[model samples]
Target: MNIKELQQYVSRFCDEKGFEGIPLETRVMYLISEIGELTDDLLEIKGATTEKQEVIKRNIGHEMFDVTWNIFDLANKLDIDLEAAFKEKMNINENREWKT
Candidate 1:
């Protein structure tokens, strides 16, 4: 689904699971925790054998999803329209010049 749909799904899921009352700061902490998990998965993959790397790769995807889900939930809590914000930011980036 698109960003808007994903945001709606997260909103509904949070409401259904009684997470709608969670504070923004707590949501940010959850997102940070997920990021740490994803980082751990990356580090594990780096040191893993080829066979073990495949397993860590799957866990990395799940961790990434968790990060994204928390972000969507945070945006919903903040009443931010991420889709519009993303488009606006991309437009600015598209027209900007890089020094490199």
Candidate 2:
């Protein structure tokens, strides 16, 4: 699904899960927690020496979804179009020169 569809899906899921009452600050905190989980997964993968790499990667994906879900939900609550904002930000980045 595209961003909008995913946003809708997540919104519905959040609603059904009784997450609709979460405040913006709570969402931000949850997103931050998910980021920490993702970071831990990444660090494990970077230092991995076993066959659990795939498991860690899967965990990382889950963490990423958690972050994105909160982002979409919060954006919806704030009436912000994340897709547009993302595209606009990318346009600016695409036009800028790298500082290599």
Among the numbered candidates, top TM-score falls to: 1
Per-residue error for 90 in candidate 2, Å, reads 2.2
- lDDT by residue for model 1 (2-75), tens: 99999999999998999999999999999999999999999888879999999999999999999999999988
TM-score of 1: 0.94
For candidate 1, give the lDDT: 0.94
Estimate, for each residue in 4-97, the C-alpha lDDT of model 2 and write its tens digit: 8888888899889998898999989998988898898898897776678888888888999988988899898898888888899999999799
Looking at model 2, the pairs that clash are none
lDDT (C-alpha) at residue 94 in model 2: 91
- Collision pairs in model 1: none
After superposition on all C-alphas, the RMSD of every candidate to the true structure, in Å, is: 1.1, 1.4
Q: Estimate each model's TM-score.
A: 0.94, 0.89
Q: Report the number of backbone clashes for model 1.
A: 0
